[model samples]
Target: MKSILFRFLLLYFALQVIPLDIHYYADVFSLPGSHLGYRGLFVLAHYTPRFFGSTPSFADWLVVAALALIGSFVWQRRQPQPDWDRWRYWVTAIVRYRLAIGLLAYGFIKLYPLQAPFPSLSNLNTPYGDFTRWKLFGMSLGIVPSYESFLGGVEIVAALLLLYRKTASIGALVIVFFTGNVFMSNLAYEGGEYVYSAYLVSLALFVLSYDAYRLFSLLVLRQPTAPNTWRLALSRPYLRWGAKAAVILVFVILYGVSAQRGYRHDPYQVPGGKGIVTGFYNVSLFRIGRDTLPYSAMDSIRWTNVVFERWPTISIAANRAAHIDASNTEAITAVSNLDKTYESQGTNGRSYYDYSFDTASHVLRLTNKDPRLGYDTLTLRYDRPDSTRIVLSGLSPSHDSLYVVLDRVDKKYLLEEAAHSGRNNHQLKL
Candidate 1:
């Protein structure tokens, strides 16, 4: 029974260690020797096999588990069982490092509040009902940066503990609880990363099993528990410490530096800097092909509210269908204005556009960020007569002549107000 269980676990986790995703190899080999920095390392650390899809899928797990089961049976039948203690140590070591890398990859992003970025102007003005459950979960975390950081800190701490042999069990315990909660939250919120979270939880549980007997004997039975005395014998001193040191240098130090740089300069989710005009504007006047249209909630063609984000992004609200970019994972490396789709992901009732500003000509060339509406492009000439008013003349998505008058609302958000005045003592004026 022991030999069968060992063989199964060995084969199962070996499948995990292998990069089944074709894109993983593409990313690995495509990096230029000169540009092989911490960014590349960070990307490598976060990799999960995507044979099924980009995100970890249940089908992928089932397939891998089946294959591992088949391979384990073959191995058991073909060869005599090796030293169980020695083999288990090596397997545990591999699992520990793998889990540590995955956790740290996510941990660093959240520690700096990059995973769930602060809501943009459009996000702020958007109706709560317009956001999907997953987006809502992320936005809720994004609003409280400190709490997000705390969660990241927990993951990082657990990951650090996993790096050492002595505290592997403790780290596994932390991950089982912490990542288990995350998995549950994903299910409850209809989040996309439930499979990945469950993957981590499974790894944690495996690691925790090493000390489960001792813990049960000590805590549940109120009996003295013996510490695990078995340790892997190393042929060389360098192999024992040198390999561990290298892993730490790469995953912890290098990845951390890269994450810090990302947080300061290029936040993965939120675009950096403010646009020429950044604010929520109420669409006071709307014209479609010289036809003056009054604002109506049911009118799909009439503009309602327009939001110019801090970046070169615009969101125009209308009674129109939106192609929601419901991406599962947040550990994205691409930071282009178009690629920064978190602002539009899982959002509806508004059309998001990535625009280029021609300061000399006062022309704003807008391209729809949604892949579904990628062909929807508009050229708008803007005139800012005052600080609070912006008038735009352009062709609508329908290729009709359009004109819009935008009146900026100096809306004071409670989140911002609460930052200055204590949340408990803030006065409500809205």
Candidate 2:
């Protein structure tokens, strides 16, 4: 237990818990961007010979590795292997507590269907080839929200189990099996959670080692095994109560409240609507420059159809070549829900825009959601002649004079209908 390897492992965990997730923490407390200034901290992190990259995980890992290497060397000369039973006990307590916190956060997000939200109209209408494997995985999960919730339930159960010493082994086992699968899935799908997921798996494996021999003797050899009855006791009353209070406050109150608010207000995944009425609209007329192009299949430049989402997004299906943001890397807490240009992400079939409307002025402002080109804006005058008809006319971003009219269509999607009315219900129509 006092081996160099054990000390090194402990040091790694210590380093990992240093709270380097600046962006996540900033977003969590709704702190101003300047508060967690990357520019200011750049020097300290750079001394990890560091990188203040977009994702702070890599930077944190680098810093920890550097510190661990130095720490191990210093400890090697000083203690030469000191009695560390007390340290181990406390470390184990910290690991289990931290593990519980991580699982709960992830579990709640999935439980509320916020991690992989229901498919947006834009996503359903998009070409299959357009989505990266990771995006496809998320959309596939989104299709079966019940299954997503089931996965979350499993995580939550594991978290609850970890809170009790008797059940900590079982909890660790669950985490290993579950997070192991998660790690593999992330690798297979090119998902962004690989590092963090693997990090949890490592912690779980360490916790499982406590009961590994007992389990092996009992289950594998069919031998009588004695359970570990040694209980952890705190020497100081304040320390014991303080630790418990801190865990509840940070893990329960802070993370729980944040996740709940996110589920209701600004979930990571797209919710039912944004800011516009969602529907498929037929492009009744198209005018560009002095040429009024008829609705001809061969006219690639003319839009065939348009889709307006309840969100602040619109999609136009045209043969015109569109730039797509195909990178599979994921960024979290970078923008608000209203500003999430989701329709344009991992989509190739149509041109999408994040739009805002001034109802009083009868004007619509649109910004093309192509991250590659920087958002391009278009200001147009709009009129709703009736409940089903919408007309828009103005100069396009290209400086070309244009006009377009849209007719609303009654469209039903199988997935959503299945959700509104239970799939097993006989009376429900597809």
Candidate 3:
């Protein structure tokens, strides 16, 4: 039983450390994608809850717990051999050296300035955005304040400690604590996706347990070195070859699977096509009913049905309609005698608002705003090409009815239009 357990432990390590398509198991377990090699397993463990739910699936926990129990039982059943030298060498090289290297590599990767492409680092506030608006966080630690640099520093320090065997135990403990924090954070806020931090934690825990055992046996037992002269087998050429082969095989498998799935070469590109805009534009007009009340009191009157409009020619009409909506309340009112104005501006002979219709979605968005409204976003949508018209549900505060038809060819043109439209250069007053 002892021999079988020892062999099983060795085989488990070989399987885990060897680069293979063992990641297929992660897919079965519903793990997220990872860039790092076997470290992906730990990432999967951290992120499992995102796909599975807040709680781990019973099967996942059961499998891990079972493996741990079996391994523990096997380890305990082994007879105590007084091969002190052999044990020490194995503990130092296999447990300490491997762990130190792994941690250092992980730290280096995190510290690598080229990691700007990562989503977490790119949009730091997005994660917090899930819980609350980013503005509520007070400090920009998670977003713009460079928290990635801070975390990288922590990893570097921990890695350095682990490399020095004397401080390895302490280093391992610190890593565990740090990684544990990351795991908890990922679980709590990351929607259960196994993040890179979780992988670091698992590696730390494994190293910690292995190193602690050796520390206990060496110091507490006061064992003298024995004559077991087995050198560390890690540096053997065959092992290096095997590790390389494993990595290549895993990559091949992953690539093949990805290809079969029809994964995109780049998923970030806008769908349909570039330089195309599409979506609905709802244009709502407010009119006064048979009432002599103020414009504010006209709020009780329901807005008119949204009018569908189009771009370029139709966009000009929509802007004119928006201006009328803002200014014509008195015209519809029975008592108010105030008159309203509407204007528009464009470049050359083109309308200020033009469409770059997206072929895929058949959507058009206004590219330019009327200069009279100053700088503002004006979006419009067309359901179909033949649909002759677009709709406007609302206008941004920058929009004005009086200057909708002014052409601002340059800054000077803009200022002249502003002045002519009865708006002060500093303030856009209707």
Candidate 4:
């Protein structure tokens, strides 16, 4: 029974380390020099095998368990080892490092506040009911960045503790609590990370099992517990510290620096480049082919509000139904500005567009960001008559000539207002 358990775990963790996706290797071979930014971080974070589908699924685990069971049988038949203690120790080390690196990859992103970015202007104005459960969960964390950073700090500390053999149990204990909460939250919020979180929790449990009896005896039974003294001696200095240092260099230092640079320069979730004008504007006048439509809450065809983000993105609020993009996973890296879907994902209240402002021609070419909504594009020419007012004339997606007037809204968010008024020191006005 002991040998069977060890063999099964060895096979399971080996499968966990090896990337089974063909595309993962393709990405590895197509590396463009040493410029591994967020792209590299993603390659590390999403290391688990996905033989069944693109996203992590429980079906894959079930298959893996079956395979491990069969392999243990084969392993026992082919070669029966006299001692399994040394082999178990080494396999546990592999799992410990894998969990440590995985946690670090996610921790750095959160540490720098890039994982759940601050809500955009459009997100702020969206109705509460318009957002999906996963979006709401992320937004709640995004709003309190300090809290998010604290969580990241905890994860980082745990990962660091995991590198040393003596402190691995402590790190595993921390992860059992922290990542267990994450797993439950994902299940409750309809998030896409429940599978991945459970994977981490499993690894933590395996590591914790080594010292579980000692802890039980010390804490529960109120008895003297002997410390774990088994240590594998590496005679060479390179064998002892070199491997550990390399792991730290790659996982912590390199990944952390890259995450910081990404946050400072180009946030992966946010579209790149600046917009011509950025503000919230009220759709004062709406005209479609010489027919003027009065503002009505029930009018699906008429635009109510338009928001120009700092990036090359625009969001329009109307009564029209929008197809929600339900992808809640990490936006590791976007190939183009149009491919960045973090802002539009899990929201159905407004239409988001990736727009290019041709300042030379005074034209705006807008394409729907949500692929589920189909490829709808609009070409409009703008005229800013004054500082507060603008007029747009062009063809709509339906090939109808359209004329619209926009009035800049001097809207202030309470969160921003409180920040400016020093919420910690001064009483908030509202």
The reply for model 4, stretches above 4 Å from the true place, is 21-35, 235-237, 422-430
How would you encode candidate 4's per-residue C-alpha lDDT over 64-176 as one tens digit per residue?
A: 88888998899999989845677768778888888998899888889988889888999998998989999999888888777899999999999999999899999999999
- Candidate 1 has an lDDT of 0.84
Q: Which ten residues in a row have the lowest lDDT in candidate 2?
A: 41-50
- Candidate 4's displacement at residue 381, Å, is 1.2
How many residue pairs clash in all the candidates, one count each? 1, 6, 24, 0
RMSD of 2: 5.0
The TM-score between candidate 3 and the true structure equals 0.38
lDDT of 1 by residue, 385-408 (tens): 999999999887678998999999
Per-residue lDDT tens digits for candidate 2, residues 21-93, read 4654443456445423221221122211113654435666767777777887788889886657766666777
lDDT of 3 by residue, 1-430 (tens): 6654554444344333322343434443553343333233223222222223334443443444455457646655574443545444454434444444445433432343211212221122112322222122212232222455566557657765765545666788988887777557545533232344554455566556655656666779977634323454565759745744443344333422332232122111011123322222222333223322222312423321221122121222121222212111001001111110111210111123333555565454544434355534444332433343332322333333211111211112332354355445336543
lDDT scores for all predictions? 0.84, 0.72, 0.37, 0.85
Which of the two, 2 or 3, has more TM-score?
2
- Model 2 segments more than 4 A misplaced: 20-30, 33-52, 56-70, 271-276, 294-300, 326-338, 423-430
Better of 2 and 3 by lDDT: 2
Off by over 4 Å in 3: 1-59, 68-142, 156-171, 184-202, 213-430
